[model samples]
Target: NAGVTQTPKFRILKIGQSMTLQCTQDMNHNYMYWYRQDPGMGLKLIYYSVGAGITDKGEVPNGYNVSRSTTEDFPLRLELAAPSQTSVYFCASSYSSGGHEQYFGPGTRLTVT
Candidate 1:
């Protein structure tokens, strides 16, 4: 199974532009998360969903939004692209949050010019 997948491996956007970063999992995981990794910094959670129709804000959710309408897809939407939002984005999924292993997708590198 394709554990987790992210589309548009790389993207470039101008200020004020908007885009959607797609993420999908074939593992039927119950937990999914979005995270951003800035240069020289650890990954910071942007948003997460425990299951379908249940979503929550993470460490950094400003300028972004997410929805979990199914167990296989969780997409991240950037309302207004900003330079500060330029970073590598990762999508991960886990069957459970209780010490279970999470499968991560190949990161999507975004640059805002």
Candidate 2:
């Protein structure tokens, strides 16, 4: 609650299943981002929002959708999940974008079988 927090630490879904990965921050950051980390690979941005009511796609946003209805919440929705969607998802928040310090959540491990 003090920083970024993510729900459902771990989850497993069969092919075609869908889920929403929840994220929240108490720091009231205006910049929020979502990223996914695959095994042995660096994190790839899925989506980002500068503030509530403004959202944009990132490096890898094909299978994901995000909405920032409020400053505290940014949820990632995985639609028609596939095996390639399996990865560790991270949520981060910062007062400003680019070079600013960011607070990251513990992450949610999602496995799509």
Candidate 3:
């Protein structure tokens, strides 16, 4: 299994442009999440999906959206990117929230101007 994979690794954006950061996991996990880690801070969840066809917003869901059309993929869509959105985006997946350590991809570093 590929665990998880994220595209671009790094990107720069202007004030109001938009982009989508791709994330995929081959572990067939039931839980997936998109989290942003700002400099010197804990990760804030942007969105989460418990399973295919089921998704919910998380703590810091603003300027972001997510969709889980399949068990292996969960991509984060950033609309109207802002400088505040500049941070490292990590795609993580777990078998269960209580008993599993989340597996993270290499991360996509986005710089919104």
TM-scores of all predicted structures: 0.98, 0.97, 0.96
lDDT (CA) for every model shown?
Answer: 0.96, 0.94, 0.93
TM-score between candidate 3 and the true structure: 0.96
For model 1, where is the 10-residue window of minimal lDDT? Answer: 1-10
Per-residue lDDT of candidate 2, residues 49-109 (tens digit)? 9999999999999989999999999999998999999899999999998799988999999
Cα distance off (Å), candidate 3, residue 95: 1.0
Candidate 3: count of backbone clashes, pairs at least 3 residues apart or interchain = 0
lDDT score of residue 72 within candidate 1: 94
What would the C-alpha RMSD of candidate 1 be, to one decimal place? 0.6
Instruction: Judging by TM-score against the true structure, name the best candidate.
Output: 1
What's the lDDT for residue 39 in model 2?
77
Residue range 15-82, candidate 3, lDDT tens digits: 99999999999998999999999987989998999999999999999889899999999999988999
Q: Is candidate 1 or candidate 3 better by TM-score?
A: 1
Instruction: Identify the superior model by TM-score, candidate 2 or candidate 3.
Output: 2
Ranking by lDDT: 1, 2, 3
Q: After best superposition, candidate 1 residue 91: deviation in angstroms?
A: 0.3
Using lDDT as the yardstick, the better of models 2 and 3 is: 2
lDDT of 1 by residue, 6-90 (tens): 9999999999999999999999899999999997899999999999999999999999999999999999999899999999999
User: Could you report the Cα RMSD, in angstroms, for every candidate shown?
Assistant: 0.6, 0.8, 0.9
Candidate 1: where is the Cα deviation over 4 Å? none
